[model samples]
Target: MPAVQKSGTVLIRAVEGAQGSSRGLEGEVRYVYYNEPVVTRVEPSSGALEGGTMLSLYGRGLEEGSNLTCRFGTGDAVAGRQETSTMATCVAPPRPVKDVVWLQVSLNGGADFSGSAVEYAYEAGATVDEVRPSAGDSGVDGQTVTVIGRHFGSGQGLSCLFGTRGRVRGMPMTSTAVVCVAPRGGPGAVGVSVSNNGVDEGQTRGGFVYSGDLKGKSAFVYYEGPERGGILVSLNGGADFSGSAVEYAYEAGATVDEVRPSAGDSGVDGQTVTVIGRHFGSGQGLSCLFGTRGRVRGMPMTSTAVVCVAPRGGPGAVGVSVSNNGVEGETASGIVSVRYEYRSGMSAKSVGRSEVRTGLGSGSVYSETL
Candidate 1:
């Protein structure tokens, strides 16, 4: 019934069994659990997190592969800071914060205790209320820019605007300023982008008033050309067809009036072609098989509309239906376009056209396509 003390190696201590505090003896000596592991710094400095971000921790005594947990501020636990054998990598969950945030992880052996933590979040996902330069400004093209939004750090988080192409640029330490050359004619106010971690906020309005009509557009033509009986399309309405083989025909000979598709055009794909001739109106319709679904970059529907591009489909003959709209001399059914490349003396139209392929997928490591 003496105070616990270590003798030789036995740690004679007291034990309060089911009864009450009582004196007892136990083997082995006890010391401090483990040394403290400190977290030093983080990289990329900032992020517009969509959820998972591999946070690299740096600090003294920090070992690789250790269990960890992360929480936003001192409140809700975003994720059970999972443990790994390596101490450096921790997948951070979505936590919205507009200021410098802190993260705490348990260093397997009771190394970190209350009050010990690392700081992150320096920026927050922001909602863009308005932009200073609008979409198209002189110095905007290919220049660093500022995006004004609510919930942003005046400076952090995911601070770049992206287009159809997946490439993204990052922002400065301040959430409000992002540094990246502007893309050609961005769009008007639309969905704002932010990082799930680092910072997050409610939806913020934003847009890219980009130059040229091609900002969010993609246009390509599958063609045979007028010489081969395929329709000839003129994109900008001129004497010469822009060689747009998948001719867009609305007018008879003189170009039809313009009816440009709205910006951010999600054109119809995967169907047949619909040619609107002179007398066409709103009531006209047609049945089409756009090869497979594909997008139409821009289309202006009119009475004398000529649709040259077929839907996203394999290279083959498809059905083209004529309906109300403008039918000056609209074709009745299948407008076959046989692509022929004459080699020696033989006209290879039918023979060469038969070798086309469709979408290919695979079960494992490899896939074949022709």
Candidate 2:
């Protein structure tokens, strides 16, 4: 057999007998030789340290085989799948830290690899710098929250976690910004975190606040006398408020008239209670206060009715107050007359028997064995 330098069509002749034997028959066949694989470049030269980045490799003289493998830096080789004669893909392995590593390919499992190598960079884990509109309504869902940070690269399994409730899928708007919908939660401040690969996470402590408080900034101005000059206040650090305008109006405080079925079970939360009122402003800040215990946000169905959920409390009667501004000292008038009672669901009557009540203060009762 003769060794060929280039890959092309050639004629191969076979001799049946030993060397120089003229009595034997000769057979000729066409054959083609392939050169060693040469990698030209690799797509997505950078990825998260948690890995799971699909890398596309393009090259010449590449062949499809079962033993194909992709090796990243000094890590173990990962199995690769061939997409075409000149294109193959593989998933990158995880790295302990940020680094720039060389990527190599192997055609025969891990025994041998291609001579050419490409550079691949592993980025640092994402960091949370700020969350815009740092506060939101605790009773509202699907509120768009923008997350600003660094090292938020493009990848799968990207999500945002609000406190410890759970995670929601995040959409990457840029390398430093991600958008996520806020989920409903209780009133308080919570930590916010972001994950690019769903394994390693970067968090901001007390990064977001869930509140029933008013959503916008408020200020009180007192004037001694009327003047011709007008007062101008800079907003957003004197940033341009293009396509926006400011206006003022005189808003009257709300007044509570009556509360229906003013009672509920003490053991449950999210009991819908209706507060009949007037001058109830419709917007994001309306809320119902259960004395000084808890405050649940309210939604105004009309100027005469504001609906709210009752929070769980100990058995007793508490004053139900409605506030259109959601401010602490701005509860509506006639609040003392409106009341809600919380009754115990079960009470002991005898040594071995208990009384089970079905509704709020007044309902059907049944005897049960304890």
- Which parts of model 2 are misplaced by more than 4 Å? 1-3, 6-33, 127-143, 148-370
lDDT of 2 by residue, 110-229 (tens): 766778989988887677766664555566665667788777766765778876657888999998899888777776555567877664456442255555544343433211112311
Judged by TM-score, which candidate is best? 2
Please provide, for model 1 over 1-370, each residue's C-alpha lDDT reduced to its tens digit, 9 standing for 90 to 100. 2433432223445565666656566654533233445655655344444445566655555443244444545654433333332345555665554465676555443333325666765444445544333333222334333555545443333445533322344464454544434543433322334342332333434433333333233433223223322222233443653333432222212122221110111232422223433433333222222223322321224435534444434333322333232211112222323221111222222111112121331111111111
Q: Which stretches of candidate 1 lie over 4 Å from their true place?
A: 1-35, 43-54, 60-66, 71-102, 109-116, 121-124, 130-148, 154-158, 164-180, 184-202, 209-370
Question: How good is model 1 by TM-score?
Answer: 0.33
Query: What is the TM-score of each predicted model, taking all chains together?
Result: 0.33, 0.37
Residue 70 of model 2 has an lDDT of 91
TM-score of 2: 0.37
